[model samples]
Target: MSVTAPAPKRIELSLPALHPEQERILRESSRFNVIRAGRRFGKSTLGRHVLMNAALQMAPVAWVAPTYKRLTPQWREICATLNPVIARRSEEEKHIDLIGHGGEIDFWSCDGGGFPGEGRKYKLIVCDEVAMLGSDLERIWTRSLRPCLTDLQGGAWFLSTSKAASSYFTQMYSWGQGERPEWKSWQMRTADNPYILPSEIAAAKQDLPAAAFLQEFEGDAVSFSGSVFTNLEQAIVDAPLPEQYERWAQQRSWMAPETEFFIGCDWAGAGRRAGGDFTAFVTMAKDGTICAIERFKADFALQRVRLAGLVSRFRPAAVLAEENSIGAPMLSALRASGISVQGWTATNATKHKAVEALALGFEEGRVKIYDVENRAVLLAELMSFEATSLPNGMTRFAAPSGGHDDLVVACFLAYLASHRPRVGECAWSPI
Candidate 1:
């Protein structure tokens, strides 16, 4: 009698239900897929499900993000799906192996001055938020991960909302739009997702500057030429204002006995209703998170009263106000009210250095800001601000003609106060 052989068990694999827009992209047979979608469009959910489906093909796949911190949440979701089929999990390496010859999954970051997953082959690559990868965008693709796909003739998917219109991501998008037959691209807005509220998007359009509204909510990569900031999407968070934690801080202050917050003020010299300049006050956490912003055109007395209200609410340790022109009177007023206020004078050189520092704060991911309604003006000013190199080798930073930088200066002072050096980096010295 001959012995019978058992067949391999069939492992059922199904993709999570996708919205029509997401499903449409996967239906294509293109070797490269690029998607530009607005915030809250469920790009992560779509990416997670697609990667899970790809795992069934028995070939290694990689997921890359701008930073490891941003990759954590998505990694958690992917791990949960692979848990049932996991053969092994390496938390330190962030790799997952499947039991049914489902190959493996790896996660990597584009930062730290190296190509992610160098010398590793993959059957598929997913680069999320390609726009945030910064100046390394060209080198990362041409010299690194793109070559790793040759062994298996693997495919890639790139996704981002677009930062600069001239960004390298834009070049890849052009390739998808008939420049390269092997590539395909699609653009979707917040409204594309049936789940997002139309009212919310409409409100954002009203609040955000025109260019910002287009890029962030409509998936258009509008160029903010010479803008002092990069990676605004990463810096602007949805955290609650400091006032929300007022009670908690009050209770905890007795235990820690340390300062929790600081404030930076830029005076507009009673420009309210006169249309000359606007005043800006920024309340910043000790760690550089901009907890709240108050921008208005008000007289000196009213401004102090408002500033005092903020001081009482957050109980900031100090208020650093610009110590020139109208700023002098504002500082004196706040000081007279028993508020701990300091005055910092801004020369062109010092101001430029401070602005540069704030820019770096955004680039290095050291800064975060609350995305409140009043924040739109500040974002607009930062994005539209220009940088000019002077003959003396000093860089000149200023807002576009007829635009306002009151908030930008306030933010610079806040960042300067937050990162004030006790020993190193005295270029940001405030007098």
Candidate 2:
């Protein structure tokens, strides 16, 4: 008689049932949903539960986190929840059975190679600690994951603790905050997790720094203490194009005759990636008000020439262009072409002092920015700006990774070069 194959066994998860908030998330069918909760609040536990449910229901799922190194513990925790029969299989064999049976979860990390090609369509995706993922991760989800989910009636789930108020995570939170038919949001604090002991909360409060306690335990988006620009929200204005420029110009025109105009230039190179960013040429009058300006963001030389033309028309009192690498070449080319430009050495002292001065100016409401298409990028950088203390006890503002401070740097240089106490008489120019 021929031997027969043993039947495959079904594995049941031994975890507790979902809580009210967890059940709410499970019932949600929105295309996008975010779960903002503190640690030990059952966010990841609920995520794993949902993944198992999707698997049992014959839905493909992907579990993504910031990095594989950080995801190992989660994987082990999830595996521990699995029945012994499934957990005993070799890793490779286990994946095969999981996919074939339709009760499986695949792991992905933002730092890993692109999405897996497992020959199975994915119906659900769970992103953990989303705040720690790089901004480009959003593009990955939009470009690759979104299209892959087309046939599965799939949805993406995001779980993260609150981050700085302007980070990628915060932006997603804001996006989900709006009334949209396709999105849902749920938030909870450490206090909401009954599993956490009261003594644990008190201990965290006593041990962790104030900002850390507020962020991790309270789920609050508080700026770090010692931040130079603590009241950054007030500095932001929602002025849209041409109108913002016109209004700013009118304001500058009202200044005294002796007021000097300063233009700060941060040049971009000649490569495609480089061309994507403009040669940011920002103009500011002596009263710390931004006046006329040009941002040459496109690739063609004609755009640069047009930008140069705008500079000529503005006739700023002084043009301070950074003279390193591509910037030096661009400045030389512009000056050679009769653009009366002055090269400002970006020494360590000058750069440091410039940023400090700009911080003071911003605090004092002496600086203004014209409304433009690039305001979002500039504002994000400004809001995320942090101050680091040196051994000499000096604090310097710098952008965090995934952040851009080119405009901020240019503005600082402009302020440093033109800053002077308001005198009785100032020259005013119309551009």
Candidate 3:
């Protein structure tokens, strides 16, 4: 770890010295500023300056994070910087009233789909680590947060290191590059910060994968490089299928009473790993259209009940599950509950074959799925699906590190179940 200079005995409400890149963007004249900066590029420091300037002028401003936990340090620093001017403070609500300047700064989190900032207005809003909001970032910004700024004719600062499946942040960055007016963007790399040693960045380059380093250290807005399934978007049907063949009434609801559907079950561990993923259920039609997708976390009893319900609803022609570790027992239990379930042991060859069939469906324009709000989870997993080639001439399939692929596995299993039918162990054939 890099060492830091000790804090002085006295506290002062002065901005820290900024490196050239930070200093440059700090003076930008733009209404909407999107900044993509690598780790340790002094983004927080520059944000402090911006907030201080706004508060000093008595401008109403707020700081937002994807989650509340990340706001603690920012809250402390902002409070300390403006302590002498703070007329009142609310520790519970995380808001402050400035005395000398009459400015007010409110701290909020977008943890609940952009509801925290509802019915409020701000002259300027700072969104830190906006990318961590994931695919919902656009929905939050456009549907909710953007309106908050309109009342005050205000601006926003969207800042982050690349951290999402979508290129929304990158699109904003492009807008700053002469694509649109009233916007400016900057890309700052860790090496640009004089304080971060070159050796540290070099070490990071070796430690992280190329794509991850570009995002985390270089601030490059990169999409996935090794996505196993290409053309996932082409298969997305944004509207609900017509009710003539649909079973449910609600938007994106799963219902196909007149047709055959397959259920794919990707079981989760029975408290095997800390923070393990959910057991994913993918219901797919024989024509490569997904009917419904459900995912949840529970013990064997709860899982059985959930599966039994789905089994009763669709009466799926076949139920295919991953047969490894807990999968075997779960399949047996599901059968004991009178749900006929088949198990497929996932070997590298078997996975390759199954995934290839799914990929071909996309290429052939045969795979189609509903674009539901909850379906974003599955789409994200599919988008970030990675395939790394091994020395043995085989490809490994999984999601990026710090992500879950249970949905993707279940999806392929559902796809496989539609085309390939086996009595016992799952055997693959080209669809």
**What tens digits encode model 2's per-residue C-alpha lDDT throughout 1-431?**
99888886565547778776677667863788887777777788888777766766766677777777767777777666664534233454224125355656777666653444434468888888776664544665677667767888787888877654345566666667776667777777887777789899998776554555566877776644345443445555556433434444334454444345677766655221254555666677666666644555655355447646555555455667777656666666676666655566665566656765666667656676656556666666667776553322233456765555567666666676576443322222222
| Model 1 quality (TM-score) | 0.58
List of clashing residue pairs for candidate 2: 256-426, 257-426, 257-427, 257-428, 258-426, 258-427, 259-426, 259-427
Question: After superposition, which runs of candidate 1 have C-alpha atoms over 4 Å from their true positions?
Answer: 225-320, 323-397, 400-431
The clash number for model 2 is 8
Q: Specify the highest-lDDT model's number.
A: 3
- Segments of candidate 3 deviating more than 4 angstroms: 1-12, 227-431
- Quote model 3's TM-score: 0.54
Alpha-carbon lDDT of model 2:
0.62
* Window of ten residues with lowest summed lDDT in model 1: 422-431
The whole-model C-alpha lDDT of candidate 1 against the native structure comes to: 0.74
Higher-TM-score candidate of 2 and 3: 3
Q: Which tens-of-lDDT digit does each residue in 1-431 have in candidate 1?
A: 99888986665644468887777877873898888878877677777776776776678888888888988887888887677677898988989998867589999986674565888888888888877775677788878989989998988888888655566778888889899999998888979887889999998775554555667888876544475587788887776555545554445363442345667888876332245678888877766677778998777788788887777766665667888777777767666666767778878778867876777777667777776657888888888887653322234577877878888888888877776642221111111
Clashing pairs in 3: 247-255
Which candidate, 2 or 3, has the higher lDDT? 3
lDDT of 3 by residue, 1-431 (tens): 99898874453565677788887897874999888889888887777778778877788888988788988889999988788778899999999998755589999887765648776888888888877676557777787778888988888888888655244777788889889999999988989899999999998776554555677888876643465566778888989754533453122233443266788988777222434679889888777788778888887778778877776666677788888888888877776666788888888889867877777676667778876435889988888888754322245677778888888888999889888744542222111
What TM-score, to 2 decimals, does candidate 2 have? 0.49
